[model samples]
Target chain A: MGIREKPTRMDQVQSWRADFPVEYLYTTGVAGERFAKTLRERGMLAATRCQRCGVTYLPPRIYCQRCFADLSESWVEVPLQGVIHTYTVVPVRATGEPSQSLEVIAYIRIDGTEGGILGRVAVSPEAVYIGMAVEGVLAPPAERRGAVTDIRYFKPILS
Target chain B: MARKRESSPQNPHDVGRVMREIPERPRGTPLKDQDIREGKVSLIAWKPHLEYRWDSGVAISRFLLGLKEGKILGVRCHSCGRTVTPPRAFCEWCFRPVDEWVELKDTGTVNTFSICYVTWDMKPLEIPQIPAVIEIDGTHPRVGFLHLLGGIGEKDVEAIRRRVRVGMRVQAVWKSPAERVGAITDILYFQPLE
Candidate 1:
């Protein structure tokens, strides 16, 4: 009816350690496919505009969240340039281990679009800053694959 | 007689209607898993390592400790008078803390069983494993826990199925003393008992 006995020592207590070995596949949706295709084939940035709210979405979407408009047929090519909205300097790798070098990850707001896409900034962390003008550097046309990685990375650009 | 309400934008009963053009077929590109495999479309693949450690509390801790010593432990609920193995602290029916720790025999009866042809990750196994609910001795009838059935020594499912049955006597096959760990895995499996 009451507490009889419990494992006081940590060693006496039983514990198990294991890791989830799971693999996942993420499909590029309708708008995502169109965006990737345009970037790969033409080296251009494509966006979908909501006619009702006049909001342009980069990494385009099929539906407008704000005005609830169908944006599938509103595909447009935005400028292949952007301004660095925000950034982070990571001293450690994704595996939670200290890295020999620092990496700069940033969200770049594509020109003439309402939303931004996350990208790696090629320059040193010290050189990266908010509002810095940057242009996307794409892979060679022959080697281009239909992925955001097709734009290898963004580099500093002169205004 | 009710008065006729004028059609105004602010009228609560009047529903605003819009003409929508519906397409003959569903929109957007659809690709099969095969298409992605063949590189027809883009897909992102990720494999993340998620680690975890689980603590075996009061009753289970003692139970696991008992298992490490090649013994099975159970808890008896004085209120319900039912002793359950793979023990728990509290009694489910009476909603009271268990009274005494009872060491049960490492023997049981097969309550139900199934022939598993695939492993946990769905990969086909060379020799199919038999998993069954074994009602441990000294516990209430039908009070059992799931464990694997081994020593069948047969690769054919039909042969194994024919040999195994409900109410068949089974005894826990414990690992060697050196291999003993405070875990259910200490008992490799349950085999048919005479």
Candidate 2:
């Protein structure tokens, strides 16, 4: 039954959707593997120091970018604290929907490390400001899985 | 070098292994699914959650709207003097812009197809899904896109492979207008025109 239909309208605009058909398995490389292993085993934060240039890297780098030298395996467990480098009030969801509430995303300069890591600051906008001291709030040891998510969210440490 | 098929006391018979006249190779051990399953190997497993919104440009936007209204549409490439389905804004044949639009008939011949036994995400299906390129009736010859073929002689792979052939006529089986989204899935499937 080949029934033909008439053209309705011409100016109608539409958007079609499909999910990104993907399952990603990432290898936490040379530096990240040990860093994550330490975080999973011990609740302390760790960083790598460049044996050549002596510059410490948080979220440890495999090599020192400044000296172009291979880094040492010397993992120094630092206190679970950092300062807010920068932040933004993300007004949208990861799904691109307008957020029901303000989500503050920030990059914190981790203590005892040159560079920092990006994390969420779970506090009111008024209470958050530049260079504010914050400590990583980790989940229980039994629930830790050696992932960045192991640190649930960062909370403001009373300065 | 001479091949060695030396025999032990168990065999003792004259043994000569047949060589296929190919280069002898070194063997490398491969990790099997069992290794990962049994946790013999240390690895991380993650299922990434992702979402994306694809922009339906000028041609596809109209094409999807047509599908919602139960119409198969194609852009007429005046530059190439031919009409192509799954409407394109540019004529790939002539390397020029296409400005004309046309509605194509539902019935067509099955140009080529396969008895796909798996879903898009590579999961096995109980009953096979037959995906085919059904050439549209009103458009130029061999102008078609990939879509599923269903309702063959029987719903089995045996019936589909033996019964479904190239040049066999087929028609679009549209979903109810209420169920039709402005997407390719609008047509539940294309069935053979008996």
Relative to the true structure, how large is the alpha-carbon lDDT of every model?
Answer: 0.86, 0.79
Fnat of each candidate: 0.71, 0.53
lDDT string, candidate 2, A36-118, tens digits: 77888898777878766877888787677886776655667776789999999888998799998888899999887887878
- Candidate 2 wrongly placed segments (more than 4 Å): A1-11, A21-27, A66-68, A72-74, A81-106, A118-145, A149-159, B1-58, B61-71, B95-99, B153-158, B174-186
RMSD of each: 4.8, 12.7
For model 1 chain B, the run of ten residues with the poorest summed lDDT: B1-10
User: Where does candidate 1 stray beyond 4 Å?
Assistant: A1-4, A123-127, B1-30
lDDT of 1 by residue, B1-194 (tens): 24445533464456577536886776656677789779877777788768899887787887888889999988899888998877888898999888888889999999999988897899998888888999999999899999999998898878987889999999999999899988899999999997
* Candidate 1 backbone clash number: 0
Provide the TM-score of chain B versus the true chain B for each model in turn: 0.84, 0.79
Report DockQ per prediction, comma-separated. 0.56, 0.22
* Top-TM-score candidate index: 1
Could you tell me how far off, in angstroms, the CA of residue A130 lies in candidate 1 after the best superposition?
Answer: 2.3
Per-residue lDDT over A13-71 for candidate 1, one digit per residue giving the tens place of the 0 to 100 score = 78778888888988888787788889888999889998889889877998998968888
The lDDT leader among the candidates is 1
